[model samples]
Target: MLRFIMQFVIILATLAAGNALSSVFHLPIPGSILGMFLLLLGLLTGVVKLRWVEGVANSHLRHMTLLFIPPVVGLLLNWGAVHIQLWKVLLVLSLSSLCILLGTGYSVELYEKRKRRRNG
Candidate 1:
């Protein structure tokens, strides 16, 4: 319980920092993207050790799919708006999926190449 609370506090603080930075720069991207980037930077820099919030963070990430529930529901409610842009939406979906697939494949190939180089 305490760990969960701490994790929540950390996430909230990161989000606040991200929002402040975005406002200062007048970024066109969403504050949430900025927050995620800040969190990734913290993780990479060891400023925020994974062990500090590992369990709670893992639990939250495990249930991250639930976060999309509200957005999906809102989309359903606003189906008419989407219907007008169905072709555009489909095009975006196709391109995004293709990008994700290509990125994953490239990352895997890179990882394998690096491993082989290190081992051999």
Candidate 2:
């Protein structure tokens, strides 16, 4: 449909602009991450309406696991290198995961407490 194409075009253009900016500025951040930040800015500023991309975005979220396929495959292919550092890799992953989980849980609890106070 025309709407679908238009939505994709807008999202892709934002990503392209972010990539261009990152390359031009020589930023260390990956272009894809920059593009996501750009997209978030656009959404917040009303430059990119949520309605325009909501459908496609939701669809992507629904099949989000597909996005990890390439990275997972690459890791598998390079498993020999990873195998040597498996313990170190797992330790780092475990610690990071624990930190993230704790951080998120505390953040949510804080938000809920504030919300309750505000409402009452």
Candidate 3:
């Protein structure tokens, strides 16, 4: 329990620092995003060990779907506004999805090819 609390605190501190940096720099991006980048940098640099926050992160991931519920509900509530732009929204979403799918597929194929070449 104590370790969990400590890990949670670390996460919150990182977010707060990110928020502060965003505000201080008048950044267009959200502070939460900046905080995430900071956390990633820390992990990559080995300044923040994965074991320190892995449990808390996994717990959040487990319930991640629940986090989207509120935003989805909000969107549904404003469906009248969204309905007018439904076609445009659908087109953008479809195109973006396709782009992401193709990009990921190409990347995986490249990675596999490289791996196979190294092994052989």
lDDT of 1 at 73: 99
Assess candidate 2 and give its lDDT. Answer: 0.88
State the lDDT at 90 in candidate 1: 92
| Residue pair clashes in candidate 1 | none
Tell me which of candidates 1 and 3 scores higher on lDDT: 3
Question: How many residue pairs clash (N, CA or C atoms closer than 3 angstroms) in each of the candidate models, in the order given?
Answer: 0, 0, 0
lDDT of 3 at 50: 99
lDDT of 2 by residue, 1-120 (tens): 788888878878878988898899999988878988998998899988899988877776899999899999998999877646668889999999999999999999999999999999
What TM-score quantifies how close candidate 1 is to the native fold? Answer: 0.65
| Candidate models: Cα lDDT each | 0.89, 0.88, 0.96
Q: Pick the candidate with the highest TM-score.
A: 3
Off by over 4 Å in 2: 81-83, 99-120
Candidate 1 lDDT over residue span 21-99, tens digit each: 8899999987878998998999999999987767777888899999999999998999878646668889999999999
Candidates sorted by TM-score, best first: 3, 2, 1
* Clash tally for model 2: 0
Best by lDDT: 3
Candidate 1 displacement at residue 83 in angstroms: 3.7
